[model samples]
Target chain A: MKNRVVITGMGAVTPLGNSVAETWEGICRGKSGIGRLTKFDCTAHETRIAGELKDFDPLRFVNKKELRRLDDFIIYALAAAEMALADAGLASGAAEGERTGVIIGSAIGGLATIEKEKEAIFLGGPRKMSAFTIPAVLANLASGHVSIRFGAKGPIGCSVTACSSGACAIGDAVRLIAEGHADCMIAGGVEAAVTPLCVAGFNAMRALSKRNEEPEKASRPFDRDRDGFVIGEGCGIVILEALPRALDRGTRICGEIAGYGNTSDAFHMAAPPPGHEGAVRCMQAALRDAGMEAAGIDYINAHGTSTPLNDAYETEAIKTVFGEHTRRLAVSSTKSMTGHLLGAAGGIETIFCMKAIDTGMLPPTINLDHPDPTCDLDYVPHQARKAAIRTAMSNTFGFGGVNAVLIVKKFEE
Target chain B: MTLEEKVISIIMEQLDVTREECVAEASFIDDLGADSLDLVELIMEMEETFDVQIADNELEKIRTIKDVFEFLKSRGTVWQE
Candidate 1:
């Protein structure tokens, strides 16, 4: 009998908006956050547009001294964690310390810091580097700083599994609770890699969308005219506590993490295999873990990266797993609005799932003007819909062929 | 600004402290709450701002703002104050 893990709180800072409330509001209203890329001058690059965050003030979350030493990714992680702890009523020492943990994941942590320090070394030799450069650029330092901020002493780690990093962090947090290692965990993913080098590297590999003329119409997942994913930056986090502990504290339970699946295609570095067999098995594994049938799921928040390959193959993967029940699944790709947040996608999309289960409203896959011939699922398109959904699944597939599926459902006694 | 004012501004910005607390007699670590890393960053910033290099051994005597002022004076930093 594994311990039941319940989500007590959630937080997010996305291209759509800075807070969970704002981002979800943007999603519910079917607003697109994709815009012109201004982080760097991409005058010669093939892809220029991106999903950039707006008005994100890091000073509100960290002190000036610490901010000078910290990178944007770590700052975003800390901000999301602070919001999550406050939402969980643990910020003021309500329920924290030894039994709590933090695990933040990022596909590429501190890319801007790395780029800056490299320039420093070039301009004034290695002696010009700041003393805190190493800590600022380390991939695991996000979780390290988050743990220090909240004094969570039990288990501390970070996941770096490309785009699946955030989902893996949350899933591993669930494992820790079920294994009796922690009563609570602050888990999620963050990314702030929208720098010159990162964008150029992705463009060199032909990974990002080139729809610079009309940014809002760019990230059209499942549409026949879909391009590549628009790289975005943000963080998403949630507080997961054991059901008994949550009940004892009388906290408002958002949802229950019923099942999780982690798999890999092992075929490509950046592309999925022929039929998305890995995704199929991954969803099956989640269902098995939840003791659920295919018909039990009422909604699916698809990974839907808006890349030509991902949207169509993901559609096939859904059909393979759910079969006839795919017709009944209210599937939507909030990435249509939020863009592809990479490692942070899982954390944000998981919150979208919980919000769906709580509000009985399914977010839409915006800008799906022309449906692909291969993509035939009913993707709650263009407009948000109200549905009494009980169970929701979120799929996140990352580079290096990693796939993670999480099943969330409304809480029941 | 004078050399003394330039060095004090660098210290203030690097240490993230108030202007009033950065008196000449105040200790960098004990008074301004600077750790070893903060001292290193402060030295780097000062060196960059003044366009001069201070040897590592001279760091031992730089415990207070007065010591920094004297060190800069001894290194031929023109004291306009």
Candidate 2:
């Protein structure tokens, strides 16, 4: 028999907030976390605004000496993992070291460190490069650092599927636990790619919003005036435990991982396929995996990226999958407030789904003032809604034509 | 600064140890609490600060603070007493 996985703990270090409580509060209040790119000099870049984090200090989670050696993404991942383990009431040494694992995801890990080292090499000589650069810049170090910190010895890995990375990590964690490879897994995604090169590169591709004057209202998902996604950075992590173990320990079950589906467009490097066939298949796969029908899902946390093509295509995909039930479904894009977290989007959004399942509150798509005619749907706009969500789905579509969907449901005996 | 003083400061900063702990006979790994990676980083810092390239073969010969001082002195590079 396949083991069931339950989410016992959740944590997030987001642009909206530093913790789950703060982020959820901002989501419920329709507050915008997007702002000017203050981390670096964006004078040369066309896209100046981003969902940059505020008032985050690594010292609270890591020592000063060690913090200097780690990249910002690794620090964020470590902080989120620490918060998750604590929330689960599991001491770092409580679980069997061999049965506990970590699988954190990132699209571009340690880009800041790489950029700094490159500058050093140019200004000074090759000898000026720091020896810690390799470990600090590798994408897998998010999981590597977490495993070493928490003493989790089993099946440590990382997923790097761009924007879908986090959701894929969670999905992989569920499979690991279901296959009895691990009793518990610390899984999610972290990203800190809000550096000069990342911003300039995205701007070159015209993938970021250039709304410098109005940063708060910049990420208007599914709106007629929406231009492109606003690049954001953060981390989100959750503790996935076997349902039986969680029940045996009397742990609080926030939600259950019912299904996960990952697919590829295989058409374009950066654009969705025609008719969003991949996304439709991806959602259908998730529903099939959960043994659920489209009508069974109570709400959908969309992958509404606030981009022109993504929003319209995702809407079409939803209409195709949910059919007539699309009108009644409470679909919203938390990215309207959080902006697009890229790799960390799926992790944080899944937590939103869990929050909706636990608290019966549907987060709103904040900046959906004038919805596009083609993208018309009930986006739970403007304010939070009080609705009993028994089953929720979160969607994440990334560059490289990757599509990932996760289904979560309220736990019951 | 003198060569010894400069080398000691670099070691202290890179390894995150105290001045008193960075004695001449102190081993980078044992007394200074530096792992292999830390030692490598300290070497990089030393190279950048002194503007001298320490080759890979020479790194294996220098394991102690005194060894580092002797290596730099033998390089015939400009240094103060």
Candidate 3:
């Protein structure tokens, strides 16, 4: 049998709030974090609203001089990692270099930094660019910064699978622990893509909600009036420890990472297959990995991005996976509350799912006033509900037909 | 664009502060809370603003707000130091 893995702690820096408690409160209250893009002026763009991180005083986590060397995503990663480590009750110097590792992923690395540098190059001569420009914006720098900060000298790397990056990173960490590659891993996703170029690109694709007038109501997942996803930024991380290691250390375990499944649709670049066959397989594979039947799942954190195709296809996938039980399952799209966090969606939604299982309360899918007939499901629409949740699954699908499903169950301690 | 105005605008934007925060005597690292990267960005902005090339050797000695002004003056850009 493979070694078991359990989530010892969790951390999140979401548009809803800076800390996990604050984020959870926002989720439970069915708050909308999407708002006018204040990171930069988006007045010229069609998509003006996004889930931007607010009041992010980086001075709380990083030194003044050190802040200049890192990108916003890296700064968010370090803050979340620090919060996770503390929540896990592990001191920075407690773990040996070989025993700990970091695997944070991002969809677009440091787009904001790149945009700034590009503007500099166009306006200034070659000598104007900073020496640290390349390293600051690289996709793998998030993992590197976290590892160096915590001295986690074990396997340190990143995954860049569009929006499924976080799920892939967490799944990789699970495999590492199961295969005896490491004892503990800091794994999740971080993204800070609230920049002019990023917003303009998504706008050009018509993939973002143009409901700039009503920012909070812009992201209406599964609703008939749903338009497009609201791009968001933040980092969500969890401390994954081998079961035996966690037990030996007498740590307070939160949940078990029972299953991880990944697949590619090979169908389209940005849209799911006509029948969502790949999504069905992804969920089925996760169930197989967890050694659990379909009926065992008590709740599902759907990848409802509020787009026309994704919400409809995801509902079809759920029906295919659970059949009759699909209607009975307490399904919700926290994206309705936090908006679409893109790369960080998987990690943060996994955290929410785990907490739902642990606390026995399903978070609501806010603004589901008028649901689409094709997207009909429990959806825990409009209000939070108390339920007996034993096992929960979080689903994440991304552009380029990438899909990842994680089965996180209540810790049996 | 006037080089001084151009440079000051970039500094204000990058630091996310106002002109009051960047008094002429303000050091990039000390008063503006600019780390190494911020300084680099400032230099990059200066280079773009003046259409001048600042070598590493020239960049190494720049410390205070006055230093940046004086260096631009020496380059024949002739701004108030």
TM-score of chain B of 1: 0.89
- How does each model score on lDDT? 0.91, 0.92, 0.88
Q: What tens-digit string does per-residue lDDT give for candidate 2 at A254-321?
A: 98999999999999999998789999999999999899999999999999998999999999999999
Query: Is candidate 1 or 3 superior in TM-score?
Result: 1
Interface Cα RMSD in Å, per prediction: 0.7, 1.4, 4.5
| Model 1, TM vs. native | 0.97
Question: In model 1, what lDDT does residue A16 have?
Answer: 94
Docking class of 2: medium
Q: Comparing candidate 1 with candidate 2, which one achieves the higher lDDT? A: 2
DockQ of 1: 0.81
Rank all candidate structures by their TM-score, best first, as comma-separated numbers. 1, 2, 3
DockQ in order: 0.81, 0.63, 0.22
Over A79-148, each residue of candidate 1 has an lDDT whose tens digit, in order, gives 9999988898888865458999988999998889999999999999989999989999998999999888
* Model 2 bad stretches (over 4 Å): B74-81
In model 2, what are the clashing residue pairs, if there are any? none
Ordered list by lDDT, greatest first? 2, 1, 3
**lDDT score, candidate 3, position A396:** 93
* Highest DockQ model number: 1
Model 2 C-alpha lDDT per residue in residues B20-50, reported as the tens digit of each score:
9988999988887788888888888788777
